[model samples]
Target: MKKIFLVAIAVFTLIACDKKEVDADANIHITGDVKGLSQGKLYLQKIQDSALVILDSIIVNGDSKFESHIKLDSPEMLYLFLDRGQTNSIDNSLPFFAEPGNIKIETTLKHFFADAKISGSKNHDLWKKFDSINSKFRDQNLALMEKRLKNELKPNATTTDSIEKAYKSLLTRKYRYTAHFAATNGNKEIAPYLALSEIADINTTYLDTIQKSLTPEVAKSKYGKMLNEHIKERKTLEVQK
Candidate 1:
């Protein structure tokens, strides 16, 4: 009876140990090359309709090699940014599934993102879903901007000033508010995407309201033209790219 009891206890201990151990999730390494650029930063952000979460970031080493590890619970949108680098490949969204172990990511770019290869997951469906959603959102944003530019409406000086001020606020706004949510929930990947998504609306609504409040002369002055021209240039850049 004693020997049988000891065997039972030993088997229970082994089971408990197995349950407690967690294998390292797949490895994730991101590689990219930028023409005529060096010493920039790369960030990975998680996306949501309501907010963005910053999952991780790293300095682009001289060799342009960067690696990170992510353990995903479910399918999520990954936002990549070259971050102030002159490289045309500044932003992209990809679907990522993190299982147990390392995955490899390699990308090559001449002007924009040219090639990307990912290995170590069989779930290609998740990637397709993410890509579709990302494209839809981008189209929606461009459409809104195009509509505003085409309207050709004019606003007074004071109102336009207020609007521009508000637009600037979008960039200056702190990330802490959105990021706090991720930290509180124990999934910190959504902060950056959440923060960036607000920039467009902040500019649009503020300009729409303030322009209606402007005086005619203020609208026609060099200052007003400068502001309008700046906005036009931004639009041009977006479309050209």
Candidate 2:
């Protein structure tokens, strides 16, 4: 009876340890982000010698956030792609000489690929970094829009001026974040400058929601036109050359 009892306890201990390992593997968190995008998608590919071995993709919610878990038996190059426009960015193939457990990569297009590495525990820390970067990007964009508006606007005009200010404000916020996000995170394939391709859509969505409060003429001011044209040209360059 004593011998049987000892065996039962040993078996239980092994079972418990096995369960813990499985739980840890399932919880290995992977995360990423893009700027100025309401939402997008990201893909992770396991590569060997510059060739893909396996591919895993996840949707970056409408808020431009994402999370996942990667199971690694060995170190491989992690390939990231933006779902919006077939954009591909790479964080130099990671050589996980150290056993892989949890890995987190958080960054915007502007500098995402430029600097992404194992951040922390790969769970909460990953989410926190993505959120932190987004918040910083928003704050910076607001400041930029404010400065640009003050420089360009007429102080005395009421309705037309207010509408124009609002339009520029919204566009500036979107463009600054999106453009920088892409630029920072992008690779040779999908550089951040390409974000300009979606500028019109972003502007249309914002203006349509507020159209009842502002006239078309005010939204199409010389400054607005100039801004859009400039962004479009940049987008063209990003894609073409």
Candidate 3:
């Protein structure tokens, strides 16, 4: 009887341990390695209530390997800030999307932001997709501006009309693309984020449509709340006009 009781207790202990491990994994876990950083500080930052806040901070010792865990209500953008106790602002912060799971970051202390490798978040991958599309629009705008500057063109009847037409065309294409993107990704958090950031001024009705299409959980997120507020303010402005 005593032997059987001991065995049962041991099995229960193992089960409890496994449950704890699973719970830990469900919380936010970040592990980092920074070469050439024997001692310093690393901070996790996020935007909250219209202000930038540090979510967590850790001290770096010998091997420059550090770990931190935090609770997340939802997936969102985060910044890794490295404070080397120097005046240089360059290469001090890196922005990445974070979700509740294990994340890893590896980089050198010198080029902290420039060469960091981050992985292990689904939301981060989605943000990359959105970023890739947004970058193309920026490249197109850059090409347009460069052509105008290089030509040393004067703003007159002959040149200004064509330039203005080109600008309008670019805006139209961007607005249409933003609408399509939001429609397709309505269930994802990135939909409202893009609507607010990429095409906030496109049209209030379209923004309203995107907001209405968001999943209930995403619609209640920080970015979603901001998007809703923006649409409301736009409507108020139109009424005043």
Report RMSD (Å) for each prediction in the order shown.
19.0, 17.9, 8.1
Q: Any runs in candidate 3 off by more than 4 Å, and if so which? A: 1-26, 87-89, 148-160
Please provide, for model 1 over 1-241, each residue's C-alpha lDDT reduced to its tens digit, 9 standing for 90 to 100: 9999999999999989754233366344434444443576667776544577777776664766666665555433466655765544444444453333455556643333445566654333333443455465556556545544544376456655654565445334322332333223222222222323332333433333333333454345333343345445556766898
What is residue 42's positional error in candidate 1, in angstroms?
0.8
Worst 10 residues of 2 by lDDT: 187-196
Which stretches in model 2 have alpha-carbon errors above 4 Å? 1-27, 48-50, 84-99, 115-118, 121-241
Ranked by TM-score from best down, the candidates are: 3, 1, 2
Better by TM-score, candidate 2 or 1: 1
- Residue-pair clash count for candidate 1: 20
The weakest ten consecutive residues by lDDT in model 1 span 186-195
Candidate 2 local lDDT, 135-171, one digit each (tens): 6656765775675577567554565566567667766
Clash count in backbone of candidate 2 = 18
Top candidate by TM-score: 3
Residue 37's C-alpha lDDT in candidate 2? Answer: 54
How well does candidate 2 score on lDDT at residue 16?
88
The runs of at least 3 residues in candidate 1 whose Cα sits more than 4 Å from the true structure, single-residue gaps closed, are 1-37, 86-100, 125-241
